[model samples]
Target: MLDAAEQYSREAFPSAKEFLRRLYDFEIYHRKTAPWNPVCVTGLPGGGKTSIFVAATRLLEDDTVNAGAGHVLPLLGFRHLTIEDERSELGILRRTCWAFNRQWSGTTSSAHEKTRLKEDDGFPMRDLKRARDTTALVGFRSGCCGVMVDEMQYMTQSTTANTLVTKSLLELSYLRFPFFFAANFNLVAKLLARPPQDRDRLLSNPVVVLPDTVATEISETAWKNYIRECKRVAGGVLDFDVDKDAESLVRYTFGLRRKFVIIIKSAYGRAREAGRFAAGMSDIEEAYKSTAYYTHRKDVESLIAMETSGKKEQKEFVCPIEVDSTEAMARHRMAQEEQGRAVAEQMVIDSLSPAGRLAYQQAGGPKPDAGEKSKGSGRVKTPVSSSSLLAGSDQFHRKRK
Candidate 1:
């Protein structure tokens, strides 16, 4: 069975879960047709690209009950798994060795020291090639059907590293081991500018772009459910007003699951510190202020505006208990009269067309007769020609002349 963390990550984001399903479907389809086709998944930071890969791979790993036809081999590697110094081809080769060896934790023993490649040992190009050969041997023996490289953006930073990584991936592709690369979408130019051979190898790879945030309804439901789950799991260690707190979280975090989790945890900590059982709106505000509110200021402001507008509408419609029935009925009648009057005014304005409405508003309602004078200024406002208004009037003379 998958661990709790992996299960939660997979279930929390429906998009990621769907992506995993599609990837699996593609894998099965490609294995029958073109077995060498790789897969690439791209997204922004904290968009759950890595989560999809982790969840998918863990599912494949933990599924011992359904020992399907052939072994479903999947391996996830990080930047550090390839080697620390990725400035050259040697570093790339070393990384391949490390990944294929599956001893990434680097627990060395004296007995195995002679056979293993030492970091400090001065090895020539031939020796490095030998290590790579050993990697291939071990990888083939281990039945590496698929290889996933997470944080692949780092590998494309330098021309040399990019070329070497591309070459390595292409070689692996030819060996029938489909590779999955996860990186930022900004690296599209670099990823496309590879050599012709690399392009040919990777061109067939399907790219999956992850959304940065969950859907509004999905997030709201998930967060409320999460609160209920927490209450049950934590055994009242943490408390929350599900509807109120979840709404605040969904709005403030703008549906970003990562930020939502961080802020809620921070708010929970604040509530605990204040000796309160429940994390409320106040704690949420405090948590948001301390976290990514400044970084995502515009989104936060928009969320605030939405909440404020909603509250304003709520207040406007709310009935007051202090008003007697007679006064309430009068107020309701007045409100209905005002609304009908405004609607009629708008209808009349709309019938006049754009030019007429402009003149009416500018002249402060309907125009007066030629002989009529203004109520306050005591002067008849005569209509002026467009050309005369553009040239010079006494009104313009004060400003221009």
Candidate 2:
């Protein structure tokens, strides 16, 4: 039987495994058949969207894994293209063609053989736009398995780039090529903003990998389990109390698995620098406050604000899927307001003298409950409506005046 930590780690990314399974089934169905709808895996920057496709590619490439499936890869092969700085439509095409060619021709061959193969394929790399559709049709006829385009968010950097990327996607869809593309929400939003036909063709099939949220009991449990798993993986170099520090860690990292790992690693490094044997909660806090984590800290704060306020701003933190409806946004805003009131109430309570506190308690003034403690600060808090607080403040100011 698997240990609790090992089991949690294994089950941490069910979406990834499901993505791979879908790829496998797609290949099985389309190996000797026509192409089907392509899959688009989307998530936050560090949510492991790319890692899912990469793992799928590895499985597909492994002969042992493919032995049961007749070992015959489908057409288009397993081509992986990373869109870094490819700004134009032609650049995307060229990159796609290159990915196809590279996969078709094994990388182990001699340089001369590689050049000859490229020549034989007649892929007009220098002038693909001029050659147009004929070049892709001819070169890709021999067949590969699938294509995966990663870092598609780069295409949204400029208007020209965005238009060109959409054009390339439309072109691929028209060709009915089987492929997968991993992108962040910006690219997904851009595609969804396109015309009906364009949006339908490209984003009809989406695989969204979202981070674990701490809003619900089930998700919070999952987050805590994930933290424990990470701690177990750290072995002897880290010795933080998972039960005690998990909540703070979740708050610090905004429940992002990657950020959690980064914080843990940084904590370990800090411990070593301070001549400590193992990193603990103090090191984790120092790491989070360190210059190295400043950008991530800002990102976490931005994400928290966006979620709680239901206001979308283009910030460095771009993950937690869009809050769609007005009702949902209002709900989030209300929750935030309630929390703010709680904090304000706690501040007032903290300012009271001992005699004032006793008198207030005796006089039935509300006290903060244990559950009202802020997650980040651990200070007692109590809820009050924004309007009530504003009215109270106005009354106090009027009396002073």
Candidate 3:
């Protein structure tokens, strides 16, 4: 079960199928047209942007799956490069050249060879431009499909790198190379902040990937389907009632698929440790409360805060893209109001005498009766410390009476 859970967590599920189909269509359209505008895939971290990239690469490289394989042949070769330590223009150009050469030659070139190639005057970019155009006409003639770049946020780490990467992208665009890059919220914000021309060149065909919000029936159905699939993949290891625990699970994970997988794995581990064959709601809660989930929980809280408040504080996670969060924000506000009411009710219960407290518990604990009213006071007493809690305390006190 543990091994299965680990493998399941690592597998990339298609959380954005519609967007993926559109992206495939976009690629096919561009391939027929010759020169294609660059496309940017942007989303919050863990929102499945990388999954789309993987799918796109598969579409281009796997003839069996490529829809356009019959007429528009997929690129003879494609490069999927992830940016990490290559933070300069020369470094990126050299790496690209090395990757292209390695793929085309079908041989592992040594680091010494790479250094030698880098030292040649106007070596990499010049060679790349010439080869790029020539490959389309000569030999097998399929030519190189544009590169897929991931972790693009690294490009914005320094001003020099950012300018160089932008220039490189513009050059590729000028060449009509159809490139795709995946970026997170931070990178998207930076791109939008650039001058109009630069932004247009890079983000002309932007696609935003988002997590399941569970705000509408359609979203709810999708969320449940995802849970059902996860349960199926777990192979009987998860035994919780999806209908009963779906809302709680969403509340805990904030609809992020990655966190959902983590919680599932953690819950399974907890269940196994407790001598159980399958996990349940208690196990889920235990996993959620475990130390391993602290960072994820904090991230979810930050996301909610950013969405509800519409403020991009240094401590909060914010997306510059305009997202339709009306229903989600309403639910969040309602939950906050309920929490405030609970706290106020607890305060009222604490102030009661022993007999009153016992009677209150006998009458159904903290949940006050709706019809009852406080004698003489006419209205419920509110805690002075929390003015926000005052309005919600009326019903609780009335029920208590």
Clashes of each: 1, 5, 2
Task: Sort the predicted structures by TM-score, highest score first.
Answer: 3, 2, 1
In order, candidate lDDTs are 0.50, 0.62, 0.61
Against the true structure, candidate 3 has what lDDT? 0.61
- Pairwise lDDT winner, candidates 2 and 3: 2
Candidate 1, residues 1-401, lDDT tens digits: the string is 12422332243223533434534464342344332555666544555666666555544432111123453433322211222334455555555545555533221223343245555353345565454444544444343334565655666657566666666555445434445666554454455676776666675554544222222344346656755675577666455576655644545665455665666678778888998876766666667666444565354444334333433232212221132454334434433454477569867866785577668867655343335443344666778898777666767778875
Name the candidate that leads on TM-score: 3
State every prediction's TM-score relative to the real structure.
0.49, 0.61, 0.62
What would the per-residue lDDT of candidate 2 be over residues 159-278, giving only the tens digit for each residue?
Answer: 576678777776554333566778777777777778987777777778767666555556568877888877777777878777676666766787788888898889999899989879
Lowest-sum lDDT 10-residue window in model 2: 1-10
Question: Which pairs clash in the backbone of model 2?
Answer: 74-144, 76-144, 77-144, 77-145, 77-146
Query: Per-residue alpha-carbon lDDT of model 3 for 185-295, expressed as tens digits?
Result: 777776777899888778888876666655557767888998998899889999887767677787778778889999889998999999998998777777777788889
The per-prediction CA RMSD against the true structure, in angstroms, equals 18.2, 13.5, 14.2
Candidate 3's error at 95, in angstroms? Answer: 5.7
TM-score of 2: 0.61
lDDT of 2 at 23: 45
